[model samples]
Target: MHKHLLPLALLTVALAACQPQSQNAAPADSGKPESATAAQPSQADRAFADLSKRWLEGWLQLNPINATQVGDHRFDSEVDDLSAAGRQKALDFNKKLIAELDAIDAKQLSRENQVDALILRNQLQGDIWSTETLQSWAWDPQIYSGLAGGAIYNLMAREFAPIPERLKSATVRMGKIPELFAQMRENLDPARVPKIHAETVAKQNNGLRELIDQFITSNADKLSGDDRKKLDDAVAALRKAVAEQQTWLDKTLVPNAKGDFRIGAANYDQKLKFSLNSALSRTEIRQRAEAEMKRVREEMYGIAQTVLKDKPTAPEMPAQPTPEQQQKAIEAALELAYQEHPKRDQVVDFAKETLAQATAFTREKNLVTVPNDPVKIILMPEFQRGFSVAYCDSPGPLDKGLDTYYAISPIPDDWSDEQVESFLREYNNRMIHLLSIHEAMPGHYLEGAHSAQFPSTLRAVLRSGLFAEGWAVYTEKMMTDAGYLNGDPLFKLVQLKFYLRTISNAILDQGVHVDGWTREQAMELMTKQAFQQEREAAGKWVRAQLSSTQLPTYFVGVQEHFDTRKAVEAKLGDKFNLKAYNDKVLSYGAPPVRFVRQLMLDQPIE
Candidate 1:
């Protein structure tokens, strides 16, 4: 649900590295056996490969800063021109790429490459279908504006370009912000901004203001006198423009906002086709989610029954508190949680220590493969806008030697005590341990580092969100299965609670956008399913509305991974060593777990 995963952002980030600018793919790896290609590839295989390369290159051009960060220098000096014409050009490119990919005789590629080609084609085809069918610009203002802020900040954060080049580009892009905002202002239909979205933007505007201030303060020393003067003037103008825009949003945008976040059945069907990359339709996802939810809930209740069996059964268990008292208890619990938040300097240290602990624990027990590359955990930048609390930014395969950034956002300073308390309770210490395991050791950082060592650029560029999030979620349970919680019921409760969140997200995402559910419905589900307190549920409800298709990946993905592991164990029998299996599993980039199974276990890619 992080807007940072927007297609352009994904493309930029996906191939972020120093790679070729030409549409030609990287020459096939030098040292692999000819058997890797499965005899001579057919015309369709060659066509898919060629189209995939061009599609990736075009995408990189569209998301330059991401390319730079991934070690691709092709677009270091350029920000995307998100003009209408530019978007049209991108659409055309995707359409063409899809056509070329579709023309290929898919079965002719090697089994592994055929799977790659199919997904590659699907991605390009989906890109075209989404842009055209959804008319995303009608609802999301973000599409109107190029993500200059994120792209620039990420490049600077990652140290992708030379500081001087980046600084200069930042200054240049700073001059462009007013125009972009102005254009966005003109292009945005007041009626198209949903009231909730307007409110979200208003909250986000404050962050943008802080971001502008932070940029000047942090980078002041890098500016020359003349350049500083120019940047200062630009910053002042942008601040004034933003202030004006905030007024416009409050007075005009919010008041007149009439946009529907839900696309309903027709559009939801289209989005399912595009976003899901599956034959699964909205109704199907919903049914699957409902069935999955019922199964998971029953399982949890079973766990509960076992845990609580010893207590004497009265007519009913005594009620603990009134609703208001329960709310107060939740608030009090949150306060206790915030007290555990590490001091700022402890951020990196905590990550390093946590990573070491997680790795040592996993490796000592040989629970899973731990990659060798050292991951550098950095403070998440304030300029990057939020949805989720933490994320992993891995170096691209093309940029193999560069460090991985496990960015964890420190709590913002200006948040009210209540907000801080609520957030902390939402992400308490036990939750942090789950998150650390997911983002650092055997989760994304470890998996991503291993993927960078993969020989295939194609695989890296086409990494699956499902695989990434699924692996992280799978690890939460895997850790518990390996006795990470020891005998603590509370720790285990938190883990189930986290998985419940994934389940809740799956339900709520489809519920809100596809089924026309209201905010209240979402909150009710989150509160019940995830045991989330009101504030956290409310936040997630809004997030569910703003983003589409992203929420389901965690649960769906993790389940796929868990299922795949079970199958792998059955196949390997006595040969299955947890470490070796995991090592083999991750050596390929983050492909769909199904495809991963096919590759690792030599199953057909059905």
Candidate 2:
């Protein structure tokens, strides 16, 4: 593996822009219920709005990278203080905010404020729990790596500011790299640091150099003499800091890191609650995932049957095949699809073609209301490579009308022929189409655009991962069901294979963290049952260890979205419109799925 490439997540980067969305209505033109014009706010609404504004201001000040990512350039030159004192300051801020929230009578607030109140309250409390309980600052080195990387990249990546201004921010942040490294070393206890995390950060340590060299030093020519000199000095200092951090990572951190990666049940459950912000329990998630796996597997086998029909070398296909027969039959069908992958060099172009295709199909079918927001396919930056193969990089709520990046990771040059083939087969032509659908067309890109239209900065910033991921996963089936790709069974099979991944992720997360499953056990579930490629399964094993509750969001989110659709359809029956239903659900900014369901169904916002 290339040590310096930092792998990124394929999450539905569900961030929002400038304003607060209405609580009870869809957009005026969305064909769902909307008041002719919004009513003037009540006193309670005014107070809640003021509280939200204050919370965001303080929160953004404390998290400057987040601010920049969210398009709040006021702190573009700042970086987060992740030291012990910094964590305490954040904790105090959150406690005070939560206390103020508690003083407000939620019932008195407008439905929108009520929803934002809950989301904000959860976020504040989650911050507190994360610091006092999970305490990843002490163990996870990736936090520092990600923050330091984002600090520079977020400033320069977008054209939100002028080149010189962004470069100036980069210089200030770059100059602080040595101090940042000092805090990373001071804040971390090697004994409590997990080895995988230590090793991952050691790999990620010098990715800062890539960011500085590519985004900063490379652009120094764009600045005037004095500014350019300052940048050169900052870049030199940043390089030294990167080297020093790498040395400590390789020598002190990696060697002495002896902490357990599995957060265990107690920590897992608490973190899960905060992370999801849904009422779903771990037990409920497991039960649903197990059941859904069986149903989805049966569906995949049925498709496999169609795809493998009359094939001479096809596996034995009884109508009621045993487990072994079913596995072989599905694998055989998938191999045929895997044979159709693009060459390594063609992956990005393939993704581009697939995205355009997904977009056209989405428009043609009218499956959902397509957003007009521009989305561009780009290569994943070197510093953001390994976590997942790709991601949708949307401008934060405060940064509207900018291009949303549909970034695909180029195949690493360092992989062996076998490894590269394994990756290609896992992400074949059909799967790339599915990924494009999920990450771009009518998925994150579409949902993000919809939520970005909502008025609340609070909802935009505290956007729900469950809703975004679930909506993305849900759209995969919706498109396939609408007969995308001329109703090819191969496409349907690959889509189910992708869905199985969601199911397996939930199962793997619990199995590793709660059930104490070993690497061997996790790999079996991914490769054999989930049908993930060796390369994909191996990466997931690492991801499952690093991310605690994140794995289940895809599963739980999609399940609730499914339930929401079913309920809405049943209620509206003959009148239910897919486009209207989709638009209405997303019209409120992307809140937790349950909250979306509540507003849709007239249930208690709680």
**Quick one: best lDDT, which candidate?**
2
What is the C-alpha lDDT profile of model 2 across 337-375, one tens digit per residue? 999999989999999999999999999988778877788
- Stretches off by above 4 angstroms in model 2 are 1-14, 17-40
lDDT of 1 by residue, 1-606 (tens): 112334542221252222222221333331212456556766665666666667667777875655555555545556665567766888888777766766677667667677677667667766666666665654566543325455445446555445666666666666666665665666567777677766666556545566666655477667788877876776777678778767876887778879887767676665555454543455665677677766655444434434444545311212344444433333333233345654443555665676777788888778766666656766666545445667777755555355667777776677777876666666666667777888877787777766655555666666677777778888878887788746455566567667778888878887887778977788878876557766578768777877777777776778778778899999989988877777877766676677887777787775
RMSD to the native, candidate 1? 4.9
As a TM-score, model 2 comes out at 0.94
Candidates in order have lDDT scores of 0.64, 0.81
TM-scores of the models, in the given order?
A: 0.84, 0.94
TM-score of 1: 0.84
Whole-model alpha-carbon lDDT for candidate 2:
0.81
